[model samples]
Structure formats: structure tokens, C-alpha cells
Target: MTLAVTGGAGFIGSNFILYMREKYPDLRIISIDCLTYASNRFVIDKLSCDANFRFSKTDICDRNEIYRLFEEEKPDILVNFAAESHVDRSIDGSEQFLRTNVLGTGVLLDACLRYGIKRFHQISTDEVYGDLPLEGDDPPFTESSPLNPGNPYSASKAAADLLVLSYSRTHGLPITVSRSVNNYGPLQHGEKFIPTVINSVLRGKNIPVYGNGKNVRGWLYVRDHCAAVDLILKNGREGEIYNVGATDYLQNIELAELICDRMRASRDLITFVSDRPGHDRRYDIDCTRLKTDTGWSPETAFSAGIEKTIEYYK
Candidate 1:
């Protein structure tokens, strides 16, 4: 199938591209990206010789440009992985997030309607459901959870998800949404938690932890996330939202400790810093629907994934 993937050069997107190429050798892929600071051009450098791959350097918010490409490629599927994903950056400057995540998503949806694309897949984060209660017996976030985004990044994404659903209903567009947990793997930007901690430890610097480092997060390996997306796009029911995550949950300090242990570094390097505003104490997603429907589950165990991540950084 011919597919148009936005943000294809970014961390998770790059892995997904590589996965698709290996899994479906002849499938044609059109990659649309702005090459933002977080985008890793090197990831797709090796794909240049493949006849099935094409990279277009353009903003997703550019409706005219996106429409031009859509008309040319006549893609069957459009998976939107584009957005300002970092919470800190969003907090510092939220306008760009809104433009890219909210407005840009609107543009893509409009294009799908105009072009009559078969499927539109939105890559979203579990943060849109806000944080789970850290100290209680609260259950994980299901697809039915009310969106309570605590930061600008998640707020914009939440708005985008709404727009996607609206188009699915009003315009008769086939749309699917996948909200996944924290993704940690190769090509991740240094500003994220795992990368930041790794870099600091490797450089013999203090490992900074936010808010006593007790905040918890559910982790998913990038490859596993990529696999889930493929299954969802292939078999997922339209207008359905699926949560993607393994049950692995780790507190900030626990994660730091894991990294330190992997690096053979000292926990003494761990340092607590002021927490960001609206820091979610915990995040967990109930992906039972995805598992039950598609028989998709995370393959990489935390220890194995963490080791691979460290090796990639080293």
C-alpha cells in the first residue's frame, strides 16, 4: 500500500519506517517532515537507495503543500506522527505546539477528506488522559477516559484527537487513534528523560531528577510501539481509539537507578531538581483492547530494552 507518513524522520517514526521496510519490502512510503531539532536525519540516511522510500521536507501545517503531495502520491494511508512532543518546550513556548499539533492536524484531516484517503491514523500520547493517581488503587487509562491534559503539549494533542474524531463522524473519514506510553529507544532527543539521564551520567555530570524523582511513567520500547501501529493500521476498526503500552511502571528515581546500574555508575550522581509545573505523578494505559483485538503485545522486557537503549547511547 502507498502510505504518507508525517514526522517520519523523528524517533518513533524513524523506527516505524525501518520496521515497515523490513516487514513489507515492496510497500511504498512517502515521508513528510519539517526536520525539527528533534528529527534525526541520519536515521533515514540508509534508506535513500530504496525505490519505495521518499522523504519530503515540508511542514504538515502547509495545507497547499500537503495537498500537492497527496494529489501526486495518491496515498492509501496517512499516519500523523508530527508534533512538538516535549513537555518542557511546550511549557516555554506553547504557540508552536498549538500550530503544529492542533492546526496542523486539522490541515491533515481536511486533506484526507478532500483526497478521499482510505485511512487516517493519529499517533497520540497517553498524557492526554492526564496522570493517574500515584498513591492509590486507581486503574489504568482506557480509551474511554476523559481527556484532562495538564500541559500545553498534551492539551494541543488532546485538541487534535478531538478534531480527528469529529472529521470521522462529520466527513465520513476513516480514522484511528493510538495513545501510547513513554517511548525510550534509539534516536530519541537528548531533552527527554532517559536520554538526559544517560547523557549526564556518561559525561560524569549530576543526573538531575524532577520532583524528588518519584513521578512514575509506563515505558514502551520504540520497536514495540512501531509494531503496534502497524497492526492497528491494518486491522483496527475505524473511529476507534487504542491505548498502547506494557504494564511496566517505574518511578523517576527507580528509572535513574536502573540507568545508573546499567552504566555501572553511582546513584550518588542522582540529584533532585525542581519539578515542572503540572508534572503528572504517574501514567499507565490499559491496552487490553489492542491486545484483545489484534493480539498485539510488547515483546521486549524492560531490562533487555534498557540494555539496548544504553548500548545505543554508548
Candidate 2:
């Protein structure tokens, strides 16, 4: 089978391409990426020798380009991972978020309808569900939960989710959406929380934490997320939404301390900074539906995942 993976040069997309290539040696992958600032081509250089893998430097928002690619590749599966994902960046400028997340997703859905693709999987974020109370009184967000995105980034993603579902209902396209929590692993951009903390601590610089550093996030190892996506691509029901997470929640302050401790750095280096606007207080996901439907659970423990991630940055 042939697959088309958009945003293949970014962190999660690149890792997913590597995982798919290794697991299905006979399957071909046509990877299209715009090579934005966070994108790194070196991640997929090793695959250059594989005849089954092809790379195209193209933007998903380009209608003609995306349609041309669909006609040329004729992929059986299409997975869209392209988006302006940083919440802070989105707050600063929302145009890119709307263009890529909303318009780009619409373009891909149109192409899928024209190509008659067997499966279209959309990779989404837990932030689309907005913040949970720090009191821990309310239950975690499930697939059935109402969308209440606070930040521009999340609002754009939530819009894309609706677009995908609309295509499924209006055009009868086979599609599935997976909303995952914060992902941390190697190859992630240096601007991200985990990588920034690890890099700063290793370099003997003050680790910056926003506000009181008490904002909570559910952490999901990147590899485990790839595995869950693979399962969904293979066996997931059409027009369904799945919440994927490891059920591990950590406060920002606590996570920073863990990294500092792991790197043998003193907590004195921790610095609290002004908080970003529209920052979600906490994010937690209820993965019961995903678990019951796909029999997939995260295998990497938080401690182990953190160690591995720290080693990668070191």
C-alpha cells in the first residue's frame, strides 16, 4: 500500500514516517512537507536510500500543488500532520494558524474526496478541549466532550476537526480524528517546553517557567502516539474521534524540576516569567474510548520517557 504523509519534516510527522517505513518495508510513502522553521530534513535522510520513500517540498495550503500530488501519488492512505502548532506563536499571530490549520485542512479534505482515498486521518491536539479546573473535581475530556478552545492555535485546530467531520458527513469520505495530549521526544523543535527545559539546564542557563508554573498538561510519549495512530489507521471506525493519551499529568513547575533533577542541575536556575495570554490552566484526556476500541495503551512510563528524552537532547 502507498501512503501520503503531510508535514513529514516536522517532529511527529518525521517520526511517524520512520516508524511506518520500518514496520512496513514494502509499503511506499510519499512525504510532503513545507519545511518550515521547525522542520528538519536530516531526520529522514537515512530513508533516501529506500526506493519506497519519496519526498516533496510542498505546502498543504496550495490547492493546485496538493491536488497535483494526489493525482500523482494516488495514495491509499492520507495522514495530515501539518499545522502551526505552537500556542504562544499562535497568540502572537493567528493568520498563519488560520491559513494552515483551517484552510490547509479544507484543501486536504477536498483532495481526499477527489482521490477517493480509503482512509484520511487527522492528527489533532488536546488543547482543542480547552482547560480543566485545577481543583481536579471535573472529569477528564472524552471524545464526546464539548470543544471550548481558548487560544488561537487550539481554536484553529478545533475548526479543522469540524471540517474533517463535515467532509465525512457531506461527501461520505472515510475519515478518523485522534486528539492527543502534549507529546515529548527527540527531534522536537527547540522552542517546545520539554526540549527547552532540557537544553537550558544542560547549557547551564536559567530555565524559564511561565506564571506560577502550575499549569498542568497530560504527557504522551511521541513513540507511543505514533503506535496509537498506526492502530487507528489500520482498524479505526470511520467518522469517529479518539482521544489518545498516557493518563500522565504533570504541572509545569513539577515537570521543570524533574528535568533539572534529571540533568543534575540545581532548582536555583528555575525562573518564573510572565505568562502568555489565553494560557490553558490544565489539560487531561479520557482515553477510555480509544482503549476500548483499539486495545492500545501507552507503553512508556513518564520517568523512562523523560530519561530517554533528556538523553536525546544531551
Candidate 3:
């Protein structure tokens, strides 16, 4: 089978490509990326000699190029991971986020409709449900939860999700959506939380903590997330939205402290700073649907995953 993965040079996208390549040695994988600042082309370069692997420098927003590529590749499945995903960048200027996240999604959906595909998976995020109370006993967000995006970044994603659902309903397009929590593992951009902490410790610099760093986030290892996406592609029902999350979760401060302890760095390096506008207090999602439907669950323990992550950075 042939699979086209957008943003395959970025963090989770690169990990997913590598995981799929190893898991299905015979699978033909086409990775598409425009080589953005956060993208690492070196990850894909290692596979340059593999006959089953191909890379294309393409932008999802370029409708003509996307259509041309789809016609040539005729991929059986398409997984879109392309987006401007930084919250701070989105707040500074939302136009790019809207263009890439929402409009780019629409372009891809149109391309799918133009050229038939067996499955089109839209990778979404739990931030679409907005923030949960940090101290409440409120249940994690389910698939049916109303979308209440708190930031421009998440708002764009929510719009894209709605567009994907609309295409499925109006055009009978085969589609699946996975709203996953924060993922951490190898090849993550340095701007992300864990990577920032690791880089700061390595450079003997202060680690900036936003608003006391108490914001909570559910964490999943990138490889485990890739496994879940694989299962979703194979066994997930059509036109369904699955929430992907793991049992591992903690406050930002706790995570930072643990990293410092593991690295034998001083916790005093953490410094509280002014928080960003509309920062979500917490992110929680229920993965019952994903687990029940795909028989998938995270295998990486929190501590073990952190150890692996630290080793990778080191």
C-alpha cells in the first residue's frame, strides 16, 4: 500500500514516518514537507536510498501542486500532519495559522475529492476542547465534547476539524480524525516544553516557567501515538473522531522538576515568567473510544519515556 504523509519532516510526523517504515518494510511511503524552520530534513535523508521511500517538497496550501502530486502518486491513504502549531507564533500573527491549518486543510480535502482515496486521516489536537480546570474533578474530554478553542492556534485546528467532518457528511468522503494530547519524544522542535527544558539545562541557562508552570498536560510518547494512528487507519470506523491520550499526566512544574532531578541539574534554574495570553490551564482527553475500538494503549511508562527522551537529547 502507498501512504502520503504531510509534514513528514517535522517532529511527530518524522517519528511516524520512521515508525511506519520499520513496521511495514514493503509499504511505499511518500513524505511531503516544505522544509519549514522547525523541520529537520536530515531525518528523511537517511532513507534516501530506500526504494520504498520518496520525499516531496510540497505545501498543502498549494492546491495545484497537491492535485498534481495526488494524480501522480495515487496514494491509497493520506495523513495530514502539516500545520503552524506554535501557540506563541499564532498569537503574534494568526493569518499564517489560518492559512495553513484551515485553508490548507480545505485544499487537501478538495484534492481528496478530486482524486479518490481509501482513507484520509486528519490529525487534530485536544486543545480544541479548550482548557479544563486545574483543580476540578471534571472528566476528561470525550469525543462528543463541544469544541471551545482558547487560542488562535487551536481555533484554526477546530475549524479544520469541522471542515473535515463537513466533507464526510456532504460528500461521503472516507475520513477519520484523531484528537491527541501533547506528544514528546525524539526529534521534537526545541521550542516545545520538554525540549526547551533539556536544552536549557544543557546550556546552563534558566528554564522559563510560564505562570508558575502549573498548567497540566496529558503526555504520550511519539512512537505510541504513531502506533495508535496505525491502528486507526486499519481498524477505525469511517467518519469517526477518536481521542488519543495516555494515562501519563502531570503539571508543567512537576515535569520540569523531574527533568532537573534526572539530569542532576538545579531546580533553581526554573524561573517563573509572564504567561501568554489565553493560556489553557490544563489539557485532558478520554481515549476510551480509541482504546476500545483499536485495542491500542500506550506502552511507555512516563518515567521510562522521559529517560529515553533525555538520552536522545544528550
Candidate 4:
């Protein structure tokens, strides 16, 4: 099967590409990326010799460029991972986020419709559901949860998701959406929480903690996410949404402490800073649908995953 994956040079996308390359050698894969600040150039270097893999430096927002590549490649499946994903960056300037996440998604959807692709999978974030109370009796968000995005980044994602669903209903486009929780592993950009802490510890710099650092986040290892997506690609029904996440919910302070403890650094190195605007107090999602339907579950424990990530950064 021929698959086209946008933003394959980014963290989760790169991990997915690597996982697929190793698991399915005969799968013809086309990875297109615009080389944004978050893109990892080194990840695609390893695929240089694989006859089945092709890398294209193209943006999903560029209709002509995406259409040209689609015409040439004629891929059966398109997995869109290309997006301006950083919340902090989006808060600073929202134009790029809207352009890439909303408009770019429209461009891709148009191409997928015109090309008559079998499936168009959109990789998404659980933040589109906004936050749950830090101290609450409310159940974790499920696939049926309402879209109540808080930040520009999430708003853009939510907009794209609505567009995807509209196309599925109105145009009969085959589509699947996977909304995942916080991803932590190797090749994640240095700006993310885990990598930022790792980099700070290595450089002997104080790790900045936002507010009281008690915001909870459900962490999913990147490889596990990749496997889940693979399962969804193979078995997920079209016009459906799947939530992918691990049960390891840790507060920001607790996560920071664990990293410091693992690296033999002092907890005093963590400095409390002002919280970012619209920071979600907690992020937890229910993956029961994915687990029951696809027989998929997270394989890596948080402790083991964090250890691997620490070793990678070291």
C-alpha cells in the first residue's frame, strides 16, 4: 500500500514513519514536510536508502504543490501530521497556526477528495476538548466530548476537525481522526515539556515550572502512539474518531520531580514561573473505544518510557 504522510520530519510523525518502515518493508511511503522550526532533519536521513520511502519538501497549505505531488504519487492513504502544534508559539502569533492548521487542512481535504483517496487520517490533539478540572468528579473526555478548545492552537485544530467531519458527511470522503494526549519521547522538539527539562538538566540550567506546576497531563510515549495509529489505519472505520492515550497522569511538578530524580539533579533546580494564558489545568482522555475495537493498548509504562527518553537526551 502506498501512504502519504505529511510532517513526517516532525516528532510523532518521524516516529510513525520509522515504525512503519521497520514493520512494513514493502509499503511505499511518501513523507512531505515544510521544514518548520519543529522539523527534525536528522530523522529523514536514515530513510535515504529505502527504495520504498520518498521525501518531499512541500507544504500542505500550498495547493499546487500538494496537488502536484498527489498527481505524481497517487497514494492510497494520506495521513496529515503537518500543523503548527506548539501552544506557546500559537499564543504568541496565531496567524501561522490558522494558516497551517485550518486552511492547510482545507487544501489537503480538497486534494484527497479530487484524488479519490481511500482514507484520509488526521492526527489530532486532545486539547481540542479543552481542560478538565484539576479536582473534579467528571469522567475523562471520550470521543463524544464536546469540542471546547481554549487556545488558538487548539481552536485551529478544532476547526480542522469540524471541516474533516463536514467533508465526511457532505462529500462522502473516507476519513478517520485520532486525538491523542501529550506525547513524550525522542526527537520531540527541544521546546516541549519533557525535552525542555532534559535539555535544562543537561546544561545545568534551572528548569522553569509554570505557576504551581500542578496541572496534570496524560502522557503517551511516541512509539505507542505510532502503534495505535497503525492499528487505526488498518482497522478503524471511516468517519470515526479514536482517542489514544496512556493512563499515566502526572502533575507538572510531579513530572519535573521525576525527571530531576532520574537525572540525579536537585529539585531546587525547578523555578516557578508565571503561568501561560489559558493553560489547561488537566488533560485526560478515555481510549476505551480504541482499545475495545482495535485491541490496542499502550505497551510502555511511564517510568520505562521516561528512562528511555532520558537516555536518549543524554
Query: Tens-digit lDDT track for model 3 on 73-167?
Result: 99999999999989999999999999989999999899999999999999999999999988979998999999999999999999999999999
lDDT of 2: 0.92
- Per-candidate RMSD, Å: 0.8, 0.8, 0.7, 0.7
Model 1 residue 133 CA deviation (Å) reads 2.1
Name the candidate, 1 or 4, with the larger lDDT value.
4
Q: Which lDDT tens digits does candidate 2 get at residues 133-162?
A: 787589889998999999999999999999
How many residue pairs clash in all the candidates, one count each? Answer: 0, 0, 0, 0
TM-score of 3: 0.99
Candidate 2 residues lying further than 4 Å off, grouped into runs, are none
TM-score of each: 0.98, 0.99, 0.99, 0.99
lDDT of 1 by residue, 65-150 (tens): 99999899988999999999999999899999999999999999998888888899999999999997779989888999999999
Per-residue error (Å), model 1, residue 281? 0.9
Which pairs in model 3 have colliding backbones?
none
lDDT agreement of model 1 with the native: 0.92
> All candidates' lDDT scores?
0.92, 0.92, 0.93, 0.93
* Model 4 misplaced regions, further than 4 Å: none
Candidate 3: segments with Cα more than 4 A from true spot: none
